[model samples]
Structures are given as structure tokens and as C-alpha cells.
Target chain A: EPEVTQTPSHQVTQMGQEVILRCVPISNHLYFYWYRQILGQKVEFLVSFYNNEISEKSEIFDDQFSVERPDGSNFTLKIRSTKLEDSAMYFCASTSTGGDYGYTFGSGTRLTVV
Target chain B: KDQVFQPSTVASSEGAVVEIFCNHSVSNAYNFFWYLHFPGCAPRLLVKGSKPSQQGRYNMTYERFSSSLLILQVREADAAVYYCACGAAGNKLTFGGGTRVLVKP
Candidate 1:
């Protein structure tokens, strides 16, 4: 089956640094999302992207965070200034329909802000 | 506030069935989804419930504010963290704390 692909399976960065996580959603999928799971915690929605703009975002998605579908195929989440609390496994997901159809998820980028 | 609740862990023997129960506090959310995740792997979609019930080896029962995931004849490979999610609309999902299943052979 086709899959969502994410780069940098693991990353360690200093607190206060900028980080950009990259993802390539399924070719035919339309909705793109970024979610984060803090270790041993529930998965939290960060942002949803559709038609090259953000559709909705959680409160956790603040000024420090932004998402872009730069090239129609690659979706990215950029954290302008990371903090220690930013450490988590960031998952990229896509769906042809909406959540009722479930989503295809990427292996995830584990970001560890030190 | 919307909250999804699930047990922390469940242990079962191989060939036994495992049922993970989930409940949510979002009264307006009717869409339920189940996902399975192995450590360091992507979360995989196991079932989707747009309505009340789904049929398959991995069955799902979705009520307006609660859902259950039934894994039939589970094997060792079925050991993983299972997450229940709900959304008021159709886009963003709010997930439960996840139930970790342990299958013994």
C-alpha cells in the first residue's frame, strides 16, 4: 500500500534552535496533518493542511509553529524556536477523505530538544 | 473539555480475543477511529467508525460518546498500543491515552 513518508527518523537539537520536519504524503491524498505524541502521552493534533493552507490548528500550535505544503508534494512543519518541551514524536498523516475514513501515517520524526 | 479515556494496559494469551474499551467526553463528536502502534513505527489505522458498528476480524462498536475495539483471535503480533480517537467534526482528532496490549504465546 502507498504510505506517508517522513524524513529524519530521529533528531536532537538545542533548545532555542529552529527545526523543520519534512513529510511526503500519499500521492492521491488531499488532507495533510501533523500530530505529536509526547513520550507516554496521548497523541495531540497540531495542525491540518488542505489546499496549501492551514485548515485548523490546535492551541498547542502557536506562533512558534507553522506548516507549509511548499511544492504540492512535500508538507513541512517548522518550529521557529524550539524549547525543551518540544521533544516528542511528530507524525505526519494524510487521508483522501476525512477522519471518518481513517488516515495513512508516516513512521514519524522523533524530535528531541535538548 | 473533550477527553478520551482508555485503560493503560491489557494482557491476553495468544489465540484469545482482546477488547479495548474507549469513552469520550465530547458530546458532539460521533466519529471514532482506532489505530495500532508498535514502538518506533507509524500508527496504523485498524478500524474506522462513521456510524455505530463495523464488521471484520478487527471489529468496532461506536456509540455517540464511546467505542470499543475488538481484536479477534489475537496473535503475538497484535501486541501494540491501541489508540481511540474522536472528532467533533471530520478533520482534527483528539486521541486517548492509548491502551497497550500484551499478547503472550
Candidate 2:
């Protein structure tokens, strides 16, 4: 079965550095999302992308955060400046355009900021 | 505020009986979900969107237990971590940390 795939399973970056987390969504899906889970915290929605544009975003997705689907299949989330609070597991998920289906999520990329 | 919860936390049961897992949420979210994960692996789709499916004794129920996945006549292979999520309007999902179940021989 097709599944969302994320790159750089783990990353370590210093405060104030930039980090790009990449994901390749299932080929046929249209809705894409980025979520993060701080250690011991619930998953929080960061942003959603469709048609090469962001559809919605959470307050947690502030000025320092951005998402781009540079290619037909590659979706990316970039953190312009990392902070200690930015340490978390970032997950990418995709759903069919119809909106009735569940999301398929990648294993995730663990981002660690020091 | 939105929250999903599974109180059992962990379970160890025998391989031939039914195990009913539970999920609760402060969210009156219309959509609920269940996903299963094997050790060292990512979560796999099991059931979603208030539609519960029954496959060889795996039954998902929405009306009761807030949302639940019932595994009948469990097997060793059924041991895994289970998670539940709830949301309204099919928007963002609020997931519970997860419940771990162990089916013994």
C-alpha cells in the first residue's frame, strides 16, 4: 500500500538555525498536513496544504514556520529559526480530496533543537 | 478544548478472549479514529471516521465507549499499541497518547 514517507528520521540543530523537514505524500492524495508532538504532549496540527497553497494553520505555526510543495510529490516544512521549545516529532499526513477518508502518516522526523 | 483518552493504559490478556478497548474525548468531534502499531513501527490504519469495521472479530464501535475497537478472540499477533483520535468537521485530530495491549500465549 502507498504510504507517506518522511526523510531525515532524526535531526539535531542549534538554536537560531534553520531546518527543513521533507515528506513525500502518497501519489494520489490531494490534502497534505504537518503535525507535531512535543515529548509527552498531544499531537498538534501545524499546517495544511492543498493545491500548492496552505489551506489552514494553527497558532503554533507562526512566522518562523513555512510549508511548500516544491514538486508534485515532495512537501516540506521549514523552520526559519529553531528554539529549544521546537524539539518534537514532526509528522506528515495526506488524505484523498473527497475528505471522507482517514490520513496516511509518515513515520515522522524527530527534530531536536539545542 | 479537545482531548481524547484511553484509561486502560496497558493490558495483558490471554489469546482466546475478546478485548474491548475504549476511547473518550472532551471533544464532541464528529469523527473518531483507531490505529494500530506494532513495536518499532509506525501506526497503521485500522478504522476511521466513525465507521467501524469488523474483520475476523475486530469490531470498531462508535456509539459506545465514546469510540472503541473490539478485538474478539484475540491472538498473539494482535498485540500492539492502539491509538484514538477525535475531531469535529473532519478538521484537526486530537490523539490520545495510546494504549498498549499484550496478548499472551
Candidate 3:
């Protein structure tokens, strides 16, 4: 089956540094999303992208965070200034349709800020 | 606030049937989905139920503001963390605290 691919399975960065996470959604998918999960916590929605713009974002998606569909296939989430609290497993997901359909999630990127 | 409730852990011997429950409180929930996650891996969609009936190995029944995932004839590979998520109107999902299933050989 087709899948969403995320680069850098694990990343360690210093606090206050900028980090960019990349994802390549399924070719036919129209909606893309970014979610994060802190250790032993529930998954939290960060942002959703459709038609090259942000459709909706959670409160956790603040000024420090930004998402861009840089190209036809690549979606990226950039954190301008990372903090210790930013450490989490970032997941990229895509869906061919809207609600009621299953979403495909990529193996997450483990972001660890020191 | 919207919330999902589930047991933190469950254990069963291989070949036993396991039923995992996901009770949610979200007035805006339009759909329910179940996902499986292995340690250090991403979550995979196991099944989704918009109504009370859907086709898949994961059976979902929504009643009285709660849903359940019934894993029939469980195997060792079925051991993973299962999460129940509610899909709101805008396609956003609020996930439940996961249930960890350990299958003994």
C-alpha cells in the first residue's frame, strides 16, 4: 500500500534552534496533517493542510510553528525556536477523503531537544 | 471538554479474543476511528466506523456515547497500543489515552 514518508526518524537538537521536519504524503491524498505525541501521552493535533494552505490548527500550533506544502508532494513543519517542551514524536498523516475515511500515518520523527 | 476513556493496559494469551473499549465525550463527534501503534512507530489506521456497522477485522459499535473495538482471534502480532479517536466536524481528531495490549505466547 502507498504510505506517507517522513525523513529523519530521530533528531536531537539544542534548545532555541530551528528545526524542519519533512513529509511526503501519499500521491493521491488531498489532505495532510501534522500531529505530535509527548512520551506516554495522547496524540495531539498540530496542524492540517489542504489546497496549499492551512485549513485548521490547534492551540499548540503557535507562532513558533509553521507548515508549508513546499511542492506538489512535500509537506513540511518548521519550528523556529525549539524548547525542551518541544520534544515529542511528530507524525505526518494523509487522507484521500475527508471525515469517515481512514488516514495513513507515517513513521514519526522523534524530536529531542536538549 | 471532549475526552476519551480507555483502559491503560490489557493482557491476553495468544488466540484469545480481546475487546477494547473507547468511551468518548464529544458532542461534535462525527466519526470514530481506531488506530494501532507499535513502540517507537507511527499510528496506523485499523478501522473507522461512521455508523454502527462497518467492514473490517476491527468491529466498532457506537452506542450511548461510547465505542468498542473487538479484536477477534488475537495473535502475538496483535500486541500493540490501541487508540480510539473521535473525528470532529473539521476533520480534526481527539485521541484517547491508549490501551496497551500484551499477548503472551
Give the docking tier of candidate 2: acceptable
TM-score of 1: 0.95
Kindly list the per-residue Cα lDDT of model 1 for residues B1-105, writing each as its tens digit.
Answer: 978999999999999989999999866788888999998888988887766565567988877788899999999988899999887555578899999999999
Ranking by DockQ: 1, 3, 2
CA lDDT scores, all candidates in order: 0.90, 0.78, 0.87
Task: Encode model 3's per-residue lDDT on A1-114: one tens digit a residue.
Answer: 888999999999999999999999999999889999999888898998888899999999999999998779999999999999999999999988765586889999999999
Q: Which tens-of-lDDT digit does each residue in A1-114 have in candidate 2? A: 888899989999999999999999999898899988897676688998888888889889999999999879899999999999999999999988523466788999999999
Report candidate 3's interface RMSD in Å: 1.7
lDDT for position B52 in model 3: 75
Compare the candidates by DockQ and give the number of the best one.
1
Q: How accurate is candidate 1 locally (lDDT)?
A: 0.90
Q: Can you give the lDDT of residue A46 in candidate 1?
A: 92
Order of quality (lDDT): 1, 3, 2
Q: Relative to the unseen true structure, what is the C-alpha lDDT of residue A51 in candidate 2, on a scale of 0 to 100? A: 81
Clashing pairs in 3: none
- Candidate structures ordered by TM-score, highest first: 1, 3, 2
Model 1 stretches with alpha carbons more than 4 Å out: B52-56
Better of 1 and 2 by lDDT: 1
CAPRI quality of model 1: medium
lDDT of 3 by residue, B1-105 (tens): 878889999999988878888888877786789899997676888877766754556778876568888887889999999999988645777789899998999
